[model samples]
Structure formats: structure tokens, C-alpha cells
Target: MRGVARTTAFLVAAAFIPIIALAQTPAGFEFQITLSKQAAQRLASSGEGITVQASYYGEPKKGAEKHVDEMGQIYLGDERIDLPGKAATARINGSGFEQAAVKWLDGPAMVNVNIFSSRKAGPDNILSCDLIDGELQVVRKSRFAVHCALIEEGMQTELKP
Candidate 1:
């Protein structure tokens, strides 16, 4: 009888081990952007250029997180603009080509990203752009600079098993 009781207790404990592990799994996030037809065209035109810079804020677990900057130069007769596409782990993933993950310490982590462009690359060449309401619009000389939008499915993180 005592053996039977011990066996039952061991089974119950074993069943909860996987549940506990799952609960303790950490959470992660990813970011992505999609360009519109006009935006793509503008980015592919000669003498046109665009730059995206992102800064992440969070706790100081492994010192200060580094900023990420990407620049795209458009050329005449170009067809496509190569933009970075991949979800970066909320935390530093040790990959030099990815952004560090967000760290929630005092509150929710925050990521502030700015996208700027110029008809011709140089200093103070910030083109007016707006990314909201599911639309990306850039204006220059009181006309459309470029058009873009967030992908139909918004950015999300995939859970690891």
C-alpha cells in the first residue's frame, strides 16, 4: 500500500514539471516594415535615398544597448530596394546584424524608430514622413515624397517550444 502511494505521488510531481517549465519560459518580440509602391519607386530612383534608425530603451542588464541604422541608396533604373527583414530577439541575440531585445525593468520597454529620406543624400536632408493609421506617407516640396504601409499582419513574436 505504501509503495502504491509513493508511485502515485511521483506521477503527480512529474506531470507538473513540464507545466512549470512552460510557465517559466521567457517572452520575446520582433519588428518588421513593408514599403508601398510609391515608397519602393522613390527608393529605387537615382539621387534618392532613405535611412532608418532605431533606438531601444530598457534595463541595463548587459550595459547600454546599441543603436541600429540602415541606409538605402537609390540609383537610376533600379528595380527594388533591399530592406532588412527579420525579427530580432527582444534581448541581445549575439548577432551583429540584429537589434537587441527589449528589457522590461521599471515598466514596459520602448523602441523609438525614425525613418528619414532625401532627394539627394547629405546633411539636414530630413524629408517629412508620417507612419500612422496603417499608412506611410512622405512629402517633399508639398508633394508626395513616398508611400508605404505596415504589413497587413502586424509585427508579432513567435513562441518557442
Candidate 2:
């Protein structure tokens, strides 16, 4: 009976090994990028026609949390934000690329992001923030500090009432 009990304990621990490993995998990156008031308005009214080309720069900011789900949905904590087909791509290292399903939460001054599965943070990272809402592919702001870190992704985008 004692041997049987020991075997059960061993099996339970082994069963949990995969679960522990899965948790450590990086889900995505959350970035809080500053944009001007007019820029914010332009992005908001773009109607899912927006995409940013931000690169990993400097150290990660401490104030952000995971705002995008694995299903590529955006949220603010428990409440979700609506942005359908908002998934887009962001390039890094000038030419090298990664596919990211982007969704944002913007206001009068800033734009928060969940660019799916980005590269690790490092210096000398220059980001070109191309706001494609309008006809021109102009990058509105340059030298904006990217505040961000890796975070787990999950949540559904809900329309604001």
C-alpha cells in the first residue's frame, strides 16, 4: 500500500511537468507608445485600417499588462475592446521580419499595443511607427520611447457601449 501511494505521487508530479513548461513560454509583447492627441483621433477613426511599425527599443516599461488574447483579441483587464480584423504585421531590424497580429488601445496621448510574438528587447532598436489610417504612409512620431515587456495573452475584444 505504501509503494502504491508513492507511485501515485510520482505520477502526479510527472503529469504537471508539461504544464509548468508551457507556462514559461512567452505569449506576446505589450507596448505603450505615446502618440499626439490628433494622432490618436486619426487612429481611432481609421476603422480597423491602422497598423504600426514599432521596433523593440530600450528597457521594458513597468506599468503595462497583457491586453491581447491568443485569439488576437484586445482587452483592458476584464473588459474587452472591439477591433475585428485588426491583425497586422510589424517589421524589426530594418529588413528582418516577424508576423504580429496587432491591436491597440489608444487615447488622446498614447497607444497601447499587443503585437503578437515580438523579438526580445535590446538597445539601438529604432522603430518606424507608420500609421496607415490615412492616404499617406507617414510615420507621425519618431524617438518615442517604447514602454513594454513580455506578457501572457488571453481575452476577447468587446465593443465599448
Candidate 3:
């Protein structure tokens, strides 16, 4: 039992080593990724669906623009260390949803925030959508915002702050 505890501790600590290293680097996103209430409310009340896409230009996976299907799968850089806490529920405009999960990893000169918005399926089932956006952004790290617009399929669109 003690060994198992030790292993879990070691693994958790190991995960942050790279993150700490990235934090030491000169470049990083200045803003933190929190729930944008206005955006969230807009999404919830909108008659049409929503989505966001961002372009990334940095080391590791440089020069790649990624597209997401929904606003929930947003992959942007956030300087804050967002713990993978239990998914919290939010109620906005009488519409609510769970955060589901927030995963992060080392990125080019920064830590990339991977967001997964939980979608309720049939009031009983829950499903995790695909990676909303996946790519390193060295170029737009400082001024990246999730774009809310109508982007046609297979079209490369850069997010606007």
C-alpha cells in the first residue's frame, strides 16, 4: 500500500518537472485560461453551434494551424498551472455544463492548456469531444483568444483576441 502511494506521488511530481522547466523559459502565455462567462453564455444561448481554431508557430510542433469543432475543445497557452481537479458545474443563463477536464503539457517555450468541455448525452450519458485544438503556438502565444465564428470545414482560420 505504501509503495502504491509512493508511485502515485512520484508520477504526479514527474508530470510537473517538464512544466517547471517550461515556466523557466523566457516565453510563455501571459494570461490564464479560465471560464469565459460571456463566451460561455453566448455559446449556450446561441441557436447555432460554436467553435474555435488557433494557429501555432513554435518549436516542437511549429507552423501548424489547428481547428476545433466546438468551443469546449480549446487548446491555448495559459501560464497558470491548472490542476486536473474534478469537473465543476457552471450555471449561466439557465444553461449549465460541466468543465469535464483540463489537461496540460509542455509546449514550445510554454505550457499548453488543453480543455475538454463535457457534453451531456441523453441526460444520462456523457461524452468527451475530440481534441478541440491541437498545436504549439510560439507565434501567437502572447495574444491568443478563442475565436467565435462560422468557419467552414477544412478551412484554416486564426483566432482573434
Candidate 4:
């Protein structure tokens, strides 16, 4: 009886070894990147040569917790301000590029990014900024100054209600 019990346990353990091994190994995957010349040129024209550095941070601005109401209006004191994309237009001004536009991504919170450059400015460089809304809300601003020997880092953009 004892010998039979031990043999039964050994057989059960051996039966599960192959199943466990299969579960531990994952199947293979494939990745591909296809970019057209026109699309590549469009991206390059946005701002390619400039090096940009940015850090997103948090702060307690006066209305940091305030957001636009359902009607798309941001109320501050006696005045009512409109939210960007609703009625307000975002105007990006920098040193290098004469023309700039906002490219919005698909998400719950609207994300608009702007990339621009200036060749004749104080510190000729690129600028990238994104306004995001979601679990964590904030406006991120980054600058790439080309001419400054040591570019004085600017303030990190924070979430402003």
C-alpha cells in the first residue's frame, strides 16, 4: 500500500511539469514601422535639428483645482474665459518658425502639442508644449535654446485649473 501511494504522487507531479513549462513561456511577436517620405518631411519641417528639454511638475496656482464647466467656460472672478478648442484659439509664438499649429491626439482629455523653432531669436531653439487633462491635469512647457552657451532653464509648466 505505501509503495502504491508514493508511485501515485510521483505520476501526478510528472503529469503537470509539461503544462507548467508551456505556461511559463510566451509566444513570439512582430513589430513594423512604415513611414512615407511626405509624412517624414512634414515631421522634419515641424522642428528637427533643435534639442528640447522639458519637465512636467505640479504646483498650487490660485485656481489649480478649477476646471472648465460643462458648457466649456472657465470662470475666474468677474470674468468668464473660454476653453481652448471650444472657442479659444491657442496662439504659439517663438523665435524661429514663422508658422505653427496644434495637433490634437485621441484621448479622454484633449492633448494639443506645438513644436516651433526660431533662428534669429536670443537663443535660437525649439519649443514644445502640451496641454493635457485626465487623472493628472497640467500644462507642460519645454524650450530648446540654441544660442545660449548655458541655456538658463525656464520654469516647468504645471497643472492650472
Tens-place lDDT per residue, model 2, 1-161, is 11122111100101111233223322222222333333233334443232333331111123332544453333222111222112222222112111122224222112233322122222222222312211011222221222111121111121110
lDDT of 1: 0.27
Q: lDDT of each prediction vs. the true structure? A: 0.27, 0.24, 0.25, 0.23
Q: Give candidate 1's error at residue 89 in angstroms.
A: 15
lDDT, ranked from best to worst: 1, 3, 2, 4
Error at 56, model 2, angstroms: 11
* lDDT: worst 10-residue window of model 4: 7-16
Model 1: per-residue lDDT, tens digit, 50-92?
A: 5444333334333322322232211111012223211111121
lDDT of 4: 0.23
Q: Which structure among the candidates has the greatest TM-score?
A: 1
Error of 1 at 94 (Å): 8.0
Model 3 regions more than 4 Å off: 1-22, 25-39, 42-116, 120-141, 149-161
User: Which lDDT value does model 2 have at 150?
Assistant: 16
Clashing pairs in 2: 80-158
Please list the residue runs of candidate 2 whose C-alpha ends up more than 4 Å from where it truly belongs after superposition. 1-23, 52-161
User: Distance (Å) between predicted and true CA of 155, model 4?
Assistant: 1.6
